[model samples]
Target chain A: MTNAAADTTPAIEAFNLTKVYGSGNTEVVAMKDVSLTVARGEVVALLGPSGAGKSTLLTAIGLINPPTAGRIVIGGQPVMEADHALVDLRAFRRQHLGFIFQKSNLIPFLSAVENVQVALEINDVLPRPARSRAMELLDYLGVADRANNLPDALSGGQQQRVAVARALANEPSLILADEPTAALDSERGRQVMELFRKVAHERGAAVMVVTHDHRSLDVFDRHFEMEDGRLKNGTERNIEQ
Target chain B: MNLATKDIRHNFGRFALTTVGIGLLLMIVMGMGGIYRGLIREATLLVEKIGADLWLVQGSTRGPFAEISRVPANLEDRARAVPGVAGARRFVSHTIQREHRGRPLRMVVQGLSWPEDRGAWIPLVAGRPLRQAHFETIADRSLGLPLGEKLKLGKDVYEVVGLTKGMVGSGGDGLCFFTVSDAVSIQFDVPGEGVRLERQARRARAEGQDIGRLQPLLLERAAGPASGIPALAPPQVSAVMVTLQPGADAAQVAATFATWPDIKVYSTQQQINLLLAGMVDKARRQLGLFRVLLIIISTIIMALIIYTLTLDKIHDIAMLKLMGARNGIIVGLILQQALLIGALGYGLAYWLGTFAFPKFPRLVVIETPDLLSLAAIVLGISVLSSLLGIWKAMSVEPNKVLS
Candidate 1:
């Protein structure tokens, strides 16, 4: 396990995570023996080159793509092993985890605040309370001024910030960020990276971000690298199968 | 629910287009229903107004309304004497065309037995009944007849003494009632001026002893005064109206008359089915075909709308899946929009169907059951049409986001 996650029990843990696409002779391993953990209140960086299977590992950890043969434990509960079984995938995702993507990916129809509120509402929060909570997040992201704006009206940085707020709306324990800064410039990208660090430290959430750019690595509590379907330099993060 | 509302708001133009398409189809469906009901409404007014218990016609034919059938005038006396009989009235029904204010009112003339006879069956709205033996009439308001209005028949002008309501024939022509003798005269009356002119023309030609003068003279000397009046009733008519005495068996009475030679007996139900219930049934069936066609067009239009709307958001759907939104959530959004359009279109259709067209010359009696059942059927089809979008949304893969 990585040192930070190993300091106490991890909020997220993977054991020998592997993903193979297609079957038999035509098969290609998108990820092989990926193992990492991020403890509560820690922010970790996953570094890789283009086509280095960063997305596959993130999808696996996000509980969307079940690993071909591996074990996943989230919040001290066994979730997927060999084949995926994560209680109800929809409920587990809605209640336990958050996700951010390279693009803002906010639903274009919803206003910035409503985009975040939808997450809380879907989890059955009362409307007034959900709206208040969404407003708090918009304020925290420094996008409260544009809270009423639709996605089409917001600047790129503002949209991505709203997406981050949406991911945090349900008070999820683990946040997975896949290339979350790829769409921003160095200054805005560093600001978004620092926000993840602040969220992890202040809210006690475990954050794992996959990125190709190394310019914002200072915001991460720890860093690991992946190459050729495996982690290369991070010995403490190597999975035991 | 939130996603559905959001999607519709974001694509307001698309949703409005869908509603317009559905509205056009709904308009056609409602129109067909109105046309079919109009025909039935008109054709039933006569029989419904008369309120008879049983109908008697020639043994081999159905008549007085549906066809031509005549029997002896003495048969009314015979029919009134049958056991369980209250009274019988002789009614002579035939069509007449006359000019009123330069427009044609094709009327069905009913020759009533007398005031104490079946005259009670017809309601007179104004003025007096036929006081004279002939040439006085009670006309339906559908003929646009006002009090004391005169209709030109050949060379004579007959004054409208009374007005009737809702009396019509199987052909949807309104009815005018007169004394049996009056009806006979109106049916047989030859204009005196025309006869005189013809006689003079024939004499001037001097071809022979003129045929017109010869026939009237020959017809008059050897016969009664009414005999020369071509308007008099024939020795017989088509049918008698039968009213039952208390606790009488209508079925048995009808059965008793069933075996009579050259005559047919019908209970009110048989008469309704053969004569009135099915007046425009074939036409209604055709209008029903048009309704089906309109609904089919609506189904196709709805399918295209939902499909296009789904395609517009292929990226959003993939992103939602990537964000761990359930397939159910995505599907609910599309289906809710479809049901919204259905509810709107049907609401407008029912409102217009019930209230808009009754004032037209043709009556549109939209039955309540038809309105309700059609609404439900249209909504069900709308939901089915919506499933195509839901299915397409469900199949999108989050892996596309990774790519």
Candidate 2:
């Protein structure tokens, strides 16, 4: 359902999403009737073991791999239903979604500032303003001093911080991250987790992170667990205020 | 920042090496084209310099360069008598090998009737024209003969009276100018021993025929000083060069000579075409085939370079896709890099050609139009070559970043 006002809209909503890997005797279901909803300003952790379909659910919601049967909405607009895309997925993704992967994956040829500015540029932002906004995001992410450095020149923690700056450069309403800190040390991972929390709380954006590290669970406002292509207990644990 | 430039800077050594490799190949392609142009220049050099409007040669031959064409020396006078004919000269040409400074030199000797005829003499680079009729010659500077030097040809020594530049025959041999009478003697005079033997045989035959009254008359006719052997007969000429009045139609005047029993007429343009299409046709075709093969090899090399570069950066491309970069952006990145490489290769080719062509054994004429067309072809090839990389980049699934 479409919300009447943007202020009251949920950041993400999905109903009965299912992803099947194959057909006939080799058929394997990766997501089973999964449903989820996250309000604006919410930070949620998707916790699961290997092969538990956390990545499948995350990729489906990220508009990368559409589910075989589902109704999905993002930022108050219906985006997909039953294997059909309701919008220009690439444009919509560019304008409304941000992704952070396990590796920084910064384009090696570009500096940190350029890496961040490119995201805005692809969204039709003028170069001058895009550059300023990139600097501002970098400043906010605590890696402003490293903006001119190449990815290889920066420390692991600094690279991830620059990646966060890039993800927020467009000020997207929703952010999806897959093991964003899997390569960082415990302290760097915790720092990256806290950065995501700050992004969600301060920017009023919804964040969904699929991660195996449980040490940073306290940073999430709500938590969900997945197992064997199913969400357990249909439960959502809200951190005590 | 431009993605193509940034990537190239990041991997400067590899990009430079690849560009240089392509540059060498492009240089070869352009060199082949230059050789073809050079052949055309050499083939038509004499025809252009002769300043003649028409050529009269033996009727059965194609022209002097394409085949043996010999017309009588008197044809020049007959050609001059034609109504629209402005002037005519007896032209004789033959290639001869002579020893010069211990090395054999092949020279194309051209005979001109008048020593003052500018149309017949090579463009003088040094010294004066042929001042003496029998033993003076103007030689092309390419022959390495200095002014006032004596050169022996067929038992006679001739002084080099003048020097000329760029005077070469269709076969790329340097040209030497001599008086028509001298050239005829040099080309056709029999040895003295052969002449003496002919005289003895005639006297023996006369003595063998013994009719009482007839014997005395025959002996007197054969032995008298008045009947002594005269000089060898005058030599024949190859062709006659004809000039036309300003208002005269060369084709029309040439047509008048068609009725002549043993001679054929040709316009200057026809002779040039004969030289090119008949004399240099095979060389042109072979050069064309080599150019085509080099182009094909350059394209394959470009495609492989771009494709391999793209493959090396699959992760980067996938990351760009994941970040919502449109397929167009990715395609542009690859295409721009390819074009840059093409430009670098073209620049290197032009530089190499400028310094290298002059040193080639044959003439190599590098013209502006050839370079412009080559640049266009290189650009087109770059675009075509980048297609494989574009396809590979576009097909990179954004979801691969997750895996």
Candidate 3:
């Protein structure tokens, strides 16, 4: 499902993004004049302390919470400009964006395979193909043997792997994660972070993960650090290993 | 897979138990409707089963079931003499309490005119109709009297020769078919001591008169047994059932009987209307009100259940919303569960009612139209009740999952 347009353009581009909450005396600026770009086939880490505007920036780029002032382009298409949507936000998210939360957030009632299949089904994909594609993604994540198990039955790492498979179900151009491996042990957390790297390079999709763990810094192709509602720096890494 | 069913499978125990609770409520609702239908059925049973075209009752009385009506037993003959009357039968009905097998049994005694009307019109579920005129009787099976059982009343013992199903009187009591003479004897039966006292009173009153001193034989006759009395009229009947000739206008025939000063007249439909309006009007209203209240309660319970189920899935719903799952998907989850609960409950109501209703003290008549109408109402309720859950699900903020 990779598009030719995605190959020729940056996967995500944010220009002068800002987000403010409340108004008057209660007004707080969560993110300020943040700008960044991530190319296809790249994995980037957003590093910050607690309340460092990392989530605000991610949500704005994901089109979940539109910024107070910004322009967002995904796969060479303008999606949102200063909270005014250029395209249907929900539809655009379903077709091109995917998210993974800290808790895995897999629907408890569905099996591991069904969790992935539902993501495709929401996009109106027929069930037969959706299931087949879901199975393939689970196999790629090495959790195919546990595909039929419910979320509660899976190990923390396995559950996060299933969540990753679900995020990759729509072949989205951009995948965002907020502490995707927070619940796992160090070994499992590193494995999950590495899985995002493999997914980004092999599927040619841009991946951004917000994580507090500094132990897996070498897994990313680039790093963006934030402080006091502003992007402090962006640095490229040489990760030949 | 359908998320609603999958979730139900995930929580099968709780969901099954909840469905059963709902099923019981539905059963009670259905039973309320059945009870009202039964009341209507009982009130008009004799009017329809006796196959009468017109009823000749006592003057200005509704009679037999709705009001007290006592006409001369010979009115059957008078009604037969009318031009349009093809047949007329003496009809007497009264409820009696008797002891049988050490249990106080209440039954409605219906007098069937022998020779002319031997209760051939009654539908017997077990055995033959009244074959003997004096003692053989047909009883409703609901009375718990088996075949060949003998019941005593008024110095006579009657044998139960036949059984009818669903036959009841206006008061929800089982009916027993007996000859008119037997029924009248039971109605007027007096203990031996009371009879003796009545005769002694008559003798004393006669002796007190100067005519008694002039004629001693008149005084002796006044003190004799009631059977030897020369001036007593025959027993009175509650009403006379008249059947008209083919193509006879019942209204015209009733108009002719209305002219007589000794009797009142009513067409069969009029008698039925009178029975419904007078005998069971309040009871029907009570059952109808109860049914409406039960339905409202069921709806409220369903709404609360669906709302709670949605609350339990709040986190999952937020996750779905963040995943870009549309509102339709979330709505489907709640709506489908509500409908499933309703359908399963409806099915269980019928399944349980099949055996349970027959055992009720009163008749429970479940009709097809009532079933269909209930199903429609349940469907509407399912949709309406699911709205609360849908509203809550829609208000779920996707950002909550991220936080």
Candidate 4:
């Protein structure tokens, strides 16, 4: 598929994705024939207990760990089929994908603006424009005032905001967030969840978040729960209150 | 903002400390090289400074430095008569230990055939060269002999007339110049008791033994020094130093002298090579070994430091890899850090060598080409040392960040 198809296609499509760890007697299936689709401007939540393969499915969709048997398309570009990368995954990921981890995972030495700018810089943006774009993203995320602060200097919520700004710096079509607000308090967590919702709605980017907290379910357009490495159908649960 | 510089700035104290440690090691390496150069300089200084085109010594021996060489003093005239030779002088060199104010001082006494020749070659720093032939001597300043001070050698006393700087033998001993007649007397003169014992022994051995014409010869040999026992055969010299006329080929003169059965002749260049390869070879090898060992130690230390630094940043490296940074970028970061450390260490070492080497007890000769070569070696070592860190960084799995 060409880039033109990306305009009208869903932001992510995974068909019968399978992931296996080890082999022979030690063989374990992490994900089994998982199929999922997320539309543009959609916010989705993945809920699961430990070892439920939520991380596995998340990593698989993030193009970090390719599935054993699967077909994945992101932004109308055929990215991976089975174990082979149909595209230059690293370059494709750099151009079309963004990630947010449980912790901010910011480069400790870089200031907030620099951390965000690094993402744009990796995408071949010049320093001046990348700096401006980083500042714009920081302002969009309400962390512009902390742009010069290093990650250590920022509060947990502020650091997460800066991380969000970093994820959006490249204008990626899809953002994969794995427990992005787990370390924050309930109010801070809700605020971060709402930020994800705003990002997906305002920027027309697909956002998938893996979280154990049910308090912010309403912030997502659809909810997913996993069990035994299998993804269940989405439930329209609105529990934002 | 270079990543390597940022990292170094982040841990400035530790980075500076490591650089200083490596700098000290490099300083020692450079000092060893300087000492080697100094040895070469001291070994060939007198040979070059003597201003002689060729050296004629006893056959079957390398002169002065390698073995004892003695030729008849009359050979000086024969060497001067050679086709290309402009002048020739009898040169006598011997080491002797003497007492000065209750302190023992070992000195190399050089005997010049013509006293006036001292002014032509020997560099006097404080006083005039030897003006009179009998008891006047020019001493190397390193001996601490004051001008006009009296020094006793054997039974004769001489006054120091001048002081020369850096006029040392191959063994680094200071040299004192005297007239050939005085040196020969001090070196070859036997004590009065030994002459009496030899005369008595000769009288006892000749009693009623030679019943023929040998009786006159035996009676004459029994005579003492006052009786002139063959006049002591004129005084032998260690070597004849020859100076060539303008445009004279030293090789041609040396070749002509080589045909003589009892004399070995060498050009000045050949003598320098002999000194360097023969006399200074062991010291040079020892210094070369030290330099090699220091280089190895430096390489190992740098490798360990870089490896430890890389290990400390494994988390950051994983994150970078996860963020789509290529292996080349990470490798470049480590290499840049290594090169920075090398440059800083070398700079510190160069500074230290410049200020510290002169204060050392021995001569340390630093040359520009040596420093340039050291820099190239340090760069090569930096690249080689960073390989360990580069390998570690490259092996870091991007998936490690997920954990």
Query: Best candidate, TM-score-wise?
Result: 3
Which pairs of residues collide in candidate 1? B59-B262, B59-B263, B184-B231, B185-B231, B188-B230, B188-B231
DockQ of 3: 0.73
The positional error of residue B242 in candidate 2, measured at the CA in angstroms, is 1.5
lDDT of 1: 0.78
TM-score of each: 0.84, 0.91, 0.96, 0.90
**Ten contiguous residues minimizing lDDT sum, candidate 2 chain B:** B224-233
Q: lDDT per residue, candidate 2, B1-403, as tens digits?
A: 4778889988899999999999999999999999889889988988888888899999878878789888778788888899899989888888888688999888888887765463234678888877677888889888989998999887689999888887888777888888887777667656777666666666676787775236676655554332353432345788898999989977789889888879988888999988888859999999999998999899999999999999988888988887788888888889999999999999998898889887786778888898899999999999999999999998888898876
Which pairs clash inside model 3? none
Clashing pairs in 2: none
lDDT tens digits, residue span A1-241, model 4: 2232246689999999999999999999999989999888789999989888899888888888889999999977788999899987777777888889988888876889988987887777888999999999899889999999888899999999998998888778899999998999999999999999888878888999999998888899998999999999987654353
Q: Tens-digit lDDT track for model 3 on A1-241? A: 2553248699999999999999999999999999999998789999999889999999899888899998999988999899999998878888888898788989999999999999999999999999999999999999999999999999989999999999999988899999888899999999999998888888888999998998898999999999988997798884774
Give candidate 3 misplaced runs (Cα > 4 Å). Answer: A1-6, B209-214, B227-231
TM-score for chain B of each model, two decimals: 0.82, 0.88, 0.95, 0.89
For residue A101, what is the lDDT in candidate 4?
90
Better model by TM-score, 2 or 3? 3
- What does candidate 1's lDDT look like per residue over B19-38, in tens digits? 86687578668767876766
Candidate 2's DockQ is 0.61
Which digits, one per residue and each the tens of the lDDT, describe model 2 over residues A1-241?
1121236689999899999988999999998998988888788999989988999998898899999998999987999997899998888888888999899888898899999999998888888998999999999998889888989999988998988888888888888999999999999999999999888888878899999998888889888899999886434555453
Best by lDDT, which number?
A: 3
Clash counts for all predictions: 6, 0, 0, 0
**What is the TM-score (0 to 1) of candidate 2?**
0.91
